[model samples]
Target: MNEAGDTGLAEVRVDVWLWAARFFKTRSLAKQAIVGGHVDVNGGGCKPAKTLRAGDRLRIARGEERLEVEVLALSERRGPASVAQALYRETDASRLARETARAERRMVGATAPPKRPDKQARRELRRLKDGG
Candidate 1:
């Protein structure tokens, strides 16, 4: 029995762990994000192959959402949502910030115009573009 079997994991690659934790849909996406400098570990940038263990701190940026999480466990294989959730614990501040930003976006978006114009509206737009 190895350490992996004894404790589920001894350590895991940062990108692999992110994918296993469901942060990224695929390992390739996780690797891309890591290589692009979208992830930080222990307040410092790390390579995709960086080894992560329990208690490690991770700052991950996924588009409009940013997360600060403390590693709680490690796994090399992706699992169900409930299982994945156990692998890391999110900080309250990170959760609050993400929710607040989402709320603000919703409030501001309510007053925005529809994404696509109607046929009549397009004609009007064309006329305006043509300077009458």
Candidate 2:
């Protein structure tokens, strides 16, 4: 059989893999990310149709977080979270970088208001906006 060893599968599209791997909520979103150049394979940008096989490396930029992963398996159909996670193996460096970035973001976010203002605060803000 092929590398993934599931029903003799051979190829899986990049976008389909991303979605099936739980990187994107839907296939359309994965396609959008691919078309927007946020997904790369083997150190270069690739089309959504690019086939991914076992051992292929991927660099994905999702919002402010970046991920580097190696394809451990291939699946064209989306599955449960636990199964989806099995499709790829994230590099240690990528996980560490993501954690560090999240920590920094949390630190910076501490300066912002945690929740919406109460009714009185809204009235005061409205008054200020009206210049009165």
How well does each candidate superpose onto the true structure, as a TM-score? Answer: 0.84, 0.81
Candidate 1 residue-wise lDDT, 1-132, digit = tens:
222212467788999899988999999999999999999999999999999989999999999899999999888878788888888899999999999999999999998877898899999999999998
lDDT of 2 by residue, 65-122 (tens): 8999998888877778888788889999999999999999998998977689999999
Off by over 4 Å in 2: 1-7, 113-132
Clashes of 1: 0
As for candidate 1, its clashing pairs are none
Tell me the lDDT of candidate 2: 0.88
Question: What 10-residue stretch in candidate 2 is worst by lDDT?
Answer: 1-10
Error of 1 at 73 (Å): 0.2
RMSD values for the candidates in order, in angstroms, are: 3.7, 4.1
- Which TM-score value belongs to model 2? 0.81
Q: Name the top TM-score candidate.
A: 1
